[model samples]
Target: MFFASDNSGPVPPQVLAALTEANTGYAMGYGADAEMVEVTKRVREIFEAPEAAVHLVATGTAANVLALATLCQPFETIFCTPTAHIHEDECNAPEFYTGGAKLTLVPGLPGFDDKMTAANLRATIAKEETRGVHGPQRGPVSITQVTERGTIYSLAELQELTTVAKEFNLPVHMDGARFANALVALECSPAEMTWKSGIDALSFGGTKNGLMGVEAVIFFDPKKAWEFELRRKRGGHLFSKHRYLSAQMLAYLTDDLWRDNARKANENCAYLAEGLRRADAPFLHEPQANMIFAALPRATHQRLFEAGAAYHLWDGPLDGDPNEKIAARFVCDWAISRDQMDHFLALIA
Candidate 1:
């Protein structure tokens, strides 16, 4: 019973099968394969942006950094929440890739699970670029769809944030490392969540869902397409055997596999949340998509760990008082079964 992370889950059979099919023949390197062409077309159609520019990288960090670099200048600063992955988890990759562009933290609305409210975003943006050339200029505004805390922003909320960014004429970027999970959870069209909501670029993710490490960077307006291609190559993120990435993404977009995977993951989280609620486990944030943050006693955690249930403690160490409560993160992936969740819950009980 592994509830550690979706990154530790198994790849879907369909993605592996596509990789095998792509391995049989020689193809042009650096994203010239026929499969890549199809992948681009598919992503464009899916997002309803006919002129969108789509490129692939092996990691979500690369996708986010390269996309941000294309939108921001070195003297500018990106706006994001304190808990954003680009800010807390990416090890300053965005700053490095953007040539020292800084990140300005926007305060999250209280009890909103680390989401930046429009008023806070506007205030933060307004505070920047006021010092002329002395201070960092305001750059693209980055929004995390499924926030680092695992709570999702509704369509209206997304539009509200983007609208605030547009007020200052700044480009908007979405760090969508869990794009499919948020998409399926919101029950909205891809266009409605992105370009229609004024997002300029997107980090379309697949690795955490089911693929074996492939993420796409999509620019709704192709004006910076050439610059992004150059930045990707210079950043050493351009894979020579690019078709393997293309194959996995193609398979993910085929037959609604991406949506199906995310749907199952969200459903699994819901089921687990129900069981946790029944057990009187207190939640730090509502289980919005495929991730849960709940508080359990130290003794209960120890019991589950001894039983081989894997997860992360968010607040403290495992050696505290037995009755002390510690918060933990539980991630449900596409591959986990009801039996496994039941086994995990039984251990908790």
Candidate 2:
């Protein structure tokens, strides 16, 4: 049983089939293929933003950095939580892509998953630009849906943070690496979670859900569309064989496959969480979407690891005291079956 990460999961058959279909003939390179056109149209219709500009990249980091570079100036600083992917996981790609724009860490609510409150965001934004030209200026505010800890922000909570950004006239960006997962968890339409909530741009994700590797960067305003295209090319994220990316994304948007995958993943995580509860394992955060952070004894972890069960320990080393509790991360993807989860739970029992 593998529960390390959704990134390790298998691609959906539909996506592979679409890639095969797109591979048959000669197609224009660099996003000129017919598949890309359909992808743009579908994303626009799905988000209800008729004038939105959609572009695809092979990685979520590229999608996020390119989108942020378009919204922020070099002298400005992006606002995000301490645990945000752009801050912790991207290896300063945001700063590098934005030509030296820095990230300002905004404190989240105490004891909750790392989600920035409106008050905290406002305070952080206010603290910046205090020294005029000496300090970094305020730039776009980035919100991570299905936060790094796997807890999701409700529609109202999303709107609240965006509203705070609007107060300062700063554009808002969503690092939606797990966009579909958060969408399915919230039970909201694409528009309600994004533009309607005042998000200026989005990094629409697919790779973690089921696609091979393809993420879309959507600009709701469309005013910065050209700049984003140029930044994407300059950043070397523009794929020459762009239709492959387009094909995967098109297949994801077709037949509600994206939502279905996310639903299955969330359901799998829920089932696993219930089993963990029965095992008397403590949770670091509620299993809201497809990821869980729970505590199990080192001996129990060793047992699972010996059984070839894959996952990550969040606290101390694996060689610690056998009875010592260690928090670990478990991610459920769409491909994992109930039998697999049952097997894992049995090991825990």
Candidate 3:
């Protein structure tokens, strides 16, 4: 039972097939391939932005940092939650790519919820620009959908945060590494989740869904498209064999494959969540979209680990009392099967 991460899962057969088809002949280098043309068209069609600018990078870090750098200046500071992926996982790539821009973490209210509120964001933005040139200026506000704690933000929540940012005329960027999962969970249109909600740019992810490795950076305004291209090239993320990336993305967007994959993942998570509930496992947060944070007793965790179950422990020590409960993270990928989930739940039982 591999509930470790979606990134560790296998690529879909269709994606590999598309790669094989794209490998048959020579193609232009540096994003000029014909496949990329179709990929852009499909992305525009999906997001309903005819004038949107889309570019592919090999990793989500490249996508996030490049997009942020394009929308922000080096002297400014990006506002995000302390638990944001850019803050915790990207290893300062956002700061490095933005050419020395600082990250000012917006502290959430006193609660387990890591999602930033409009009032908190307003307070955070207000705290900045006070030090003049000595302190960093307020840059763009970055929102992480399906937040780090495995919670999905609602449309109204997004609009509220964006409205707060717009009060200061700040551009907003979305860290959409799990964009499809959140979209499917909310049952909202892509436009509603993004531009209509005041998102200026997005890091549209695919690797976590089923692709081998590809993430698209989309700018709704299209004004900073060239700057992003230069930044991507400078970061060495522009693949010479660009058709492979484009091919995977095209396959993902075609026949509603992306939506289907996300639905499967969410369904799997819901199934697992129900089983966990039956097993009396306490949830750290409600399973929202393909990810769960639940606490199982140390004895049960040890048993699962001995039975070859894979997952992440969110907190507490495994070596202490056997009855102690330790928080663990279980991620359901598109490829995870119900049989595997049943086996895992059986182990816990």
- Candidate 3: residue 174 lDDT (0-100): 98
What lDDT tens digits, residue by residue, belong to model 2 across residues 1-349?
A: 8999998899999999999999997999999999999999999999999999999999999999999999999999999999999999999999999999999999987876379999999999999989989999999999998898999999999999999999999999999989999999999999999999999999998989999999999999888989998998999999999999999999999999999999999999999999999999999998899999999999999999999999999988999799999999999999999999999999999
Candidate 3 C-alpha error for residue 235, in Å: 1.2
The lDDT values for all models are 0.94, 0.94, 0.92
Q: Relative to the unseen true structure, what is the C-alpha lDDT of residue 17 in candidate 1, on a scale of 0 to 100?
A: 98
lDDT agreement of model 2 with the native: 0.94
If scored against the real structure, what TM-score would every candidate get?
A: 0.99, 0.99, 0.99
Candidate with the larger lDDT of 2 and 3: 2
Model 1 lDDT tens row, 125-244: 999989999999999999998888889999999999999998899999999988999999989999999999999999998999999999999999999999999999999999999999
TM-score of 2: 0.99
TM-score of 1: 0.99
Query: Could you report the Cα RMSD, in angstroms, for every candidate shown?
Result: 0.8, 0.8, 0.9
Clashes of each: 0, 0, 0
lDDT of 3 by residue, 221-340 (tens): 988899888988898888988988999999999999999999999999999999999998889777889999999999999999999989989898778999988999999999898999
Error of 3 at 121 (Å): 0.2
